[model samples]
Target: METCSLPRRKLAAPLLALLTTLSLPTPASSAEIHSYTLPQQAYSGSRERHYKVYVPSAMTTPAPMVMALHGCKQTNDDVLNDWGMKAAADRYGFILVAPFITSYDGLRNENCWGFWFEQHIHQGAGEVEDLHQIAQQVDAAYSIDPNRRFITGLSSGGAMSMAAAVAHNDYWAAAAPASGLPYSEDSSSVSLSGQCPGSATFHAVSQVVSDLTGEVDNGYPIPLLLLQNKNDCTVLQTAANNMRDAHLQVFGSGDFKTAATTKASDTSCSPYNQNNYSCHRIAYTQDGTTATRSLVETIFYDGPLTTPNAQDTDHGHYWVGGAEGNNGKWALQIGPSYPDIIWDFFSRHSRNGSQPQGHPVIVLQGDNPLTAELNSAFSDPGATANDLEDGSLNVSADCSAVNTQAAGSYSCLYSATDSDNNSTTATRVVNVVDSNSPVASCQKISASPYAHIGAGRAYVGGVSSLRAYANGDNVDIGGSFDTWSSVALYEGETGKWYSQLPAACSGTGGGFVCQNWNTTNLNHVTAGRAYYGYYTVGGNQYLGSLPGVNSWVKETASGYFQAGQCSN
Candidate 1:
């Protein structure tokens, strides 16, 4: 237990008198508080401790037990009276056990439980062993349920309670550590020296718990409920976040999902981060094959300190109820009732958990491919679905968005539903692209009978010329080939064209052919400047170029001028 050491100040006379009047006990309540002394051999050395149990007079059947621990410099009587545990027990029909820590003059400066010490906290020895024995003793004396045992504490007691729950997890079903630090190897040192950040301390605590409890594929072995104050300066909010993260890491291995989130009403509490005093309520469930249950829950409250010093500043160290000191300045003003929330959560869970319903699984076929050619057909590959409880599910697909006639990417969804109404879905992508190329041919014509004319032929200007034709299987002959075909003569070595047909060729019977040569400005043939004829249609859909043919040379043949003279 750590105490906030602040300068003492004198209180006003009237307020001091009022606090004195409130400190006195009223009449005896319906619940009877019983005191019990532990066996001398139960604890180590002469430093012995006692425990108090709260049992309602109306108790007839076996009831659940909650082991509550107090902070440093606090007694079991203070915890019972100030925290209203007796009243809670009467209302909730449960038993309450509060233990008092004996002061050690030289060993400890404060009357705090030795929760930080290694020997006192571990299994089979120290405080944990003593607490276990006391539980057994209480069970024998009163009707107690073994599966419904729980533990909680504040400050150092809260820290110790966490350690006890971990060491004796087999006995305790759940634990709630409110405004408390985690039990770590460095805890004893930190408590004796000073305090560290909550996250740094809890990281070490997580490692220690992992070492003690062998790592399992499933989530945390025991359910946990964490409570913290947003404005707490002593314990700090980081500690609660770290503790929550640690428990989630231990228990959130499989398909763990957040089930619900509840925000407190603004009228009941102040807003922190736009959330009310009972800031937020988050619940998580781990749906494992063997055991499915709600594993963890957390509540963050926005309020003044549980105990405020003389300066009206809150240290936020105590449990939900205000303690004996500070004149009720640290009492909760707005938020959900703490005792009611705690009992509701605890009562709903037990040691034997329930099985969870599994979700459906959907498997989709690989990506589909299609061509963009006109009138191309498309067929879906389909999908598959399965479930653990619901056998093979009927999978339905929707490919209405797919248009095979257009050239673009498209998507469709495959979905399935189980008997339990659990649904699963998958997406398939359809890629459509153009896969057709245009077919074309060119022929050279010679005016001179001496020139050889064929597909690969060339003749001098004014003596012969060339013509080309093209057609596309997937393209509109009149709109594409007829409107975009052309022919040109270019330098074979340089690839620089000398001239091109001004406009597209006209449409013939089944294809498109180049226009009349006389209607175009064809470059004059020149000697020693090698050139070739080229035909292009539909933006490179089809292209024709000269194939290793030499330009014709001027010559005289049969007493007539000829342009078909070749060296070979």
Candidate 2:
């Protein structure tokens, strides 16, 4: 953690009041600001350190201490500007501390947290000792609650926080790491010592996590609140998943399977089920972008830190230190609402091998994308399956509120779990599209397989084809037939009704046999009725008409013509 303390530059009365109101509360009404000097030892020599502290005014007795660690290439003052842990301490009424790392080049200017474990803390013994000394000094100076001490950080600071949990587990009640992972690094020039809080050392948090579940090899699972972003380009989301899985592999005893899932564009989470500890992973995926935020909440079945379930702060830098978030830096900060959620989780948990309260758990969608409806169940011991496996839990969710946009009734059926060790057995279904009437086209047709036919003449009957093509729509052929009554016949040469046709030409010139003199009607004749009526099938049309007579003959005034005919 970086340590330079930011001065209390007074603000406008109104603005100061507003900021003060925004602070999380303590029993006291005001928070005090103070600074301390710490001594540290380096591979080459020794040095002194500095850090800032904020004490809630309402706390008469020892109040909880929360240490905030800064990220890499950042200073304590820089973190203060980016991460607003001080404001959170004032509002929440908890003691806040920010420690600084020292440089070994005798400059004391290139500040950095010394190695987390004694292995490195020894090389720079003064720096680690300075941190411990400051804590002791504060313990003596005020009502500092030793049992309720907590540590949290981001990036490199986050890794250091893990080290702190391993190296100083007795000093902190819980640990929260944002966008960070366990150390697997070897010694390097930049980092003089092997990782701090190495696997060889297991503190209270890790020991309790291991003891409850039964894993001994991995770094102990401290009472932890893990947050990561699925879409984070810098830190891979897989690391967070691995951490959650390790917990379940050691503790879970029932039938639940872990699942990878997302709800919107901003985040995502992995699945884990074990006795006492239930994995709550959140992923935000909006549009095509992956959500860069993840939250890991752990609870003890028994002990002073037992809670039904833990709530976590958002992980996206966009929402960090905003009115509703925790962790991260950039344009958007964690919100004011974040502190409460963090405290709620921490207050209910400890790495003491205690049984979780087994509180009835409910899952609800937050403002983020990876959300499911509230599910009620008892977190039981052992491995537990998804809620869908039991056919009792409803993981249907509405994703319309994501990205602060008004989405139209979109929902999803997802997998989930409860405390009872049961699994989801059925699929949940939801509808998101509209059910309004379809759009209209320029034309319409009969139900199915329908066609128009030509009215039969007095001596002939035939079928007429009607084919209409409409834009943006299709016509149905309902296998039914109707007749067209608009056909009229007239003599092409005489200007009169010429109801006759030319007979076979084998005889004198061309024997006339009631020739079809209606030029207009004859000109309109073509091919089959279904087609455009242009081609002739062997010099004749397939009009359902009587045979044995001159083909193209107009019907008499009685409305009958002579042509080929078929079955009724």
Candidate 3:
């Protein structure tokens, strides 16, 4: 979100020309920021929405992608050029997309995204659908990874980023809403000149889940990073804190404490404070839990504006810590580059929690039906497999047990093996029922980028982790050890269940549970379970309303690697 200095649409002639020059994408022969217009298939208010994507030179075909939504009065060009996002693409080898509002004629000519518009925030509606369509289009054209997709925005765009994440939880692995107000149901958050009260934007923990009833109930569990600035008069720090707590409740996090504080001045990141903001990484571990888990983090800044060639420092609403020499309006060159910060968080996650590298990913071609009628014709829906080392592997299906002759349960195992001889399997349990009607799959979709924060973490020992997701309908949901009663890891393939860590679980609500260990001084966790809405509670198993993917991630390194997100 650029153009925070002075009034919107009132920029002088020379500045406008400079902005025009800066916003243009560099020559395609080098790196590129190509623009396109996507037709609006869902929304009636607008005919089409415009967006631009930046594909770095020599990027991998299935590289991750992030959608950067700009603030009102800002164009996609500002994001790619002014904010150093394009340059970051060169370094990170990831695609960057900036979405522009159909119209920018805002109140005071500061028009931006429709943060207050219900159509934009809710799914199956207007703008949110448009965004999803845009993402699907990108995937079709570029073959971007469905699991590693991300979304972010500034100011009003920030509000949309977080809000849209709620409505379309299945699409994004993670979301970073930077330098924006906590989103509830309010229009005041978009006011650049006035401070929006936190009460209007922040929701209580109890209300957070309730307020997001229809959506959260049927979507993937996604982690968030809320970026804020303390020195800004437009949006207050209280809003950021309220938002942090709000999301913790959404994630069902026990308690988050400030674990580390790093100033750009303390490292080589910002020796001269070129990026002048400080990041406070928060950890969810408290009460004797291992220290590696983090559900949500607040990358905040409270400092004098010393950006290289920034338009002004009066408003803290701009990108706080960005690449040096922003030299444009609405972005401060204070703090380390945010692209690295956001990318770090984005890299560790995908649509199904953590993606195990080199493993063959098997996708079921037919819907995993939960129920079938008695004495009926049953066909096994087959699957396909793709691996990192082996381009495409064959998936063998065994559905011989799926007999519609009697009313009971049947199972099919989809198996795939990569070139490295590492094998993986997906279990599809189809319930042969007493009724005549065909089994129906839930209309809503969901994904768990990480089944829980610790689902795919590479730690030395059994890691303390949390798996909290929307439990609209938990037929046989059991993993939620509402309390840290026992540490357990069950391998369905091996039919082996063992005690692994202490656990706390709360359910019939969100299937929320915590698996904790006393220390992080152990080896990489060998405990993980693949979920496809199938769970067993008290020996009775059930399928959830929102079925998800069954994928595995195997990583053996701690996730302290440095990375991008133009967060705050």
Best by TM-score: 3
Per-residue lDDT tens digits of candidate 1, residues 6-103?
Answer: 11124444222212111212113355776665544433532455778777655534677888888776778767765656656765567888887754
In the range 413-480, model 2's lDDT, one tens digit per residue, is 33444556432322222222222322111111122122222211212222443432111122222222
The per-residue C-alpha lDDT of model 2 at residue 535 equals 22
Model 3 spans > 4 angstroms off: 1-29, 44-47, 104-109, 190-206, 253-275, 285-293, 305-313, 355-568
Q: Give the distance in Å from residue 179's predicted Cα in candidate 1 to where it truly belongs.
A: 1.0
For model 2, what is the error of residue 408's alpha carbon versus the real structure, in angstroms, after optimal superposition? 23
Model 1 bad stretches (over 4 Å): 1-29, 42-47, 104-109, 188-209, 212-220, 255-278, 288-293, 306-313, 322-336, 353-568
Model 1: per-residue Cα lDDT at residue 504? 21
Model 3 earns a TM-score of 0.52
Sort by TM-score, top down from the best: 3, 1, 2
- Give model 1 RMSD, 1 decimal: 28.9
Against the true structure, what is each candidate's TM-score? 0.48, 0.40, 0.52
Give one clash count per candidate, in the order shown. Answer: 2, 124, 42
The segments of candidate 2 whose C-alpha lies over 4 angstroms from its true place after superposition are 1-29, 41-47, 104-118, 121-130, 184-221, 245-319, 324-331, 334-338, 350-568
